[model samples]
Target: MTKKRNMWNILLASPFILAVLTCFIVNFALDRQFSWSLLTAASCLYAYLMLYTLIFGGKHRILFTYLVLAILLIPFLYIIEYTANLYLPQPIYWTTRLGIPVSLAWLAALAVTALLKTLTHANGFLTTGYFILAFYAAERCTNNRIDAFIGPNDSWSLSDHYPILYFSAAALFLLLGLITTAVKRSRSRA
Candidate 1:
């Protein structure tokens, strides 16, 4: 019975994992980059964990399980460093060990998932959106210097001059996440 149920869970969750994995793979072929892919994979992983827990059934005590899954993926970042020439190790290593660590961000995401078990409301959207935005912001802010092209020869590449866009996005998502949390709280009460 247990084995059969596990199979059912895997079968249900396989499509989401495959789609996110495909997106990560295709970003390399189409854009020649994995920075965006890394962000997507991390976001998808968070949602996957939530969905997996929901299907297999974990309640109140699954936070650490989800957190372990998040930590395991830190090593996964090495793949991006190799393929995209992004200097990921130093930032992640230093930040993870010496400071707050990326795992905390994932923990927050999972906590939100646990709080809002159903993904059919604004809370659900906010929870997934928060994870996506937070993970992306973490990646973007840690090593934000990029040589992005805006037009033919009109490039916006310098890190010094291009802090605005990334910062604004991060700030906006954070504010949204907070507002969502407040709204979710009020809804739960009523």
Candidate 2:
């Protein structure tokens, strides 16, 4: 059975490997170098790993998937930055400064989602609400970091109006989650 499963895994992985190889061959043929193809290979590898984890990760599939994502994300971004630097004419070296922080922000969102799931032990609605809120925070962090990277705009006011919209959406979702949880609890009691 294990042999069969391993064979199936190899069969599934074949397409991904083929695609990456094809990308590399075509890229090298066209450009006489392997710049963007490296990114393609890295992305394909990450996708395959995620798919494999979700399909065969056992009981803690989601948590394991998150772990896989966290471990691979840095290397993936490095590939992206390297590809971008090589492909672009200008020497754009923002992997350490911009990419890492943005990735960290997203990772923080994932951590919040995992924490909420473990702590609440309630329906998905509350967890989703928390996830959405965490996403908003992550986006906000990304925006701030980008602004700083792109040179602070002294002309424009620091107070951006976008946060209000995100905050309102988060608030609505939290309210809905609270109502749903309350109704579910009451129903269970009755």
Candidate 3:
């Protein structure tokens, strides 16, 4: 893609970028917090941008900038969880308690992105859903269920064999990506 096109993509995705950053500033500004849906959507956009940059950016400054900013976002998340009196989901909250850096979380996210490879060529919906669900499953398997930002209320413990949930979601993602690729190829052939 041309520089202009890349710029346009980043510009268009700026809302999501802002939303992700808001996790840092939100405590000072708003009484209410962002919903899980909103956070998940922002995360998906961030993941999408990162996936694009990592896979197809190729010396493009614009895409590289996006990727760098996304990496830098880890610090902002850290600041929010550490400095700000904000609520974090149980899975993430445990990380804070365990002193696991957000950079590691980001690295885990990168590994997920790279492993799936669906984010590179799939439609936005497919990619976004995959990213969201994959992370959600990770969160689930870490403790067994998704929880609110404050903490988990359910009995989702750390000892449960929730690996099935995580792996099943991953397999579903691969299946969807394969189906999409097959359809696109068939369309072009026709």
Candidate 4:
């Protein structure tokens, strides 16, 4: 059983690592100024993971659901980024762009949900709370460095988007958790 679980973990993590490598390769090869490669790689990774989860049946259904939710959320985040670019007085830095609020939120959410799923095997509000706390800590630690590189206005304003994104991601994961639990309960009765 332990070996089986380890194999599952490797299977689940493989696509993510591949996606990261894809981004690196694209970044190095294209030498593009924009970081679109990362986004593209992430999209591809999410899609691959979803397919893998749906076909193989694993503990990653919740994570896959969050990935799907994050993909759905990209448009909304792009809207915000576009709108903010238009309304804000200064030119928006690409790095600090507020385009995908939910995507960022989803990252925080996913991290929290993964942590909870690992530690307690529970998917409750506490998971969300941990996500929020972790996000806050991360924001605090990174804010200064980000501001220094992106400019103070860009750093301060865009930073707020992270927590929101994290929460949105967490919500998706939580929803998936609930659904998975329901399915398991039903199957057990049968």
C-alpha RMSD for every candidate = 11.3, 2.6, 10.0, 12.5
Alpha-carbon lDDT, every model: 0.57, 0.84, 0.56, 0.61
The TM-score between candidate 2 and the true structure equals 0.87
TM value for model 3: 0.37
Tens-digit lDDT string for candidate 1 (1-190):
9899889878877887887789878988888876667756766666676666655655643654565456655654544344344545443333334223444545555565555545535444455555555555554433332212112343444334665655566567657867888887999999
Model 4 gets an lDDT of 0.61
Expressed as tens digits, the lDDT of each residue in 1-190 for candidate 4 is 8798769768877867877787778777887543555466555655665666664656677666666656555654454455446547895644344323324654765676577757867655546656655665556545654555557774344347666666667577667767777887899999
Candidate 3 per-residue C-alpha lDDT over 128-178 given as tens digits, one digit per residue, 9 for 90 to 100: 546666575455444422343336665645325465665566567667767
Off by over 4 Å in 3: 1-103, 110-120, 124-159
Runs off by more than 4 Å, candidate 2: 154-159
Candidate 4: where is the Cα deviation over 4 Å? 1-46, 54-57, 60-109, 121-123, 153-190
Give every collision pair in model 3. 88-149
Clashing pairs in 4: 77-99, 81-99, 105-165, 105-166, 106-165, 106-169
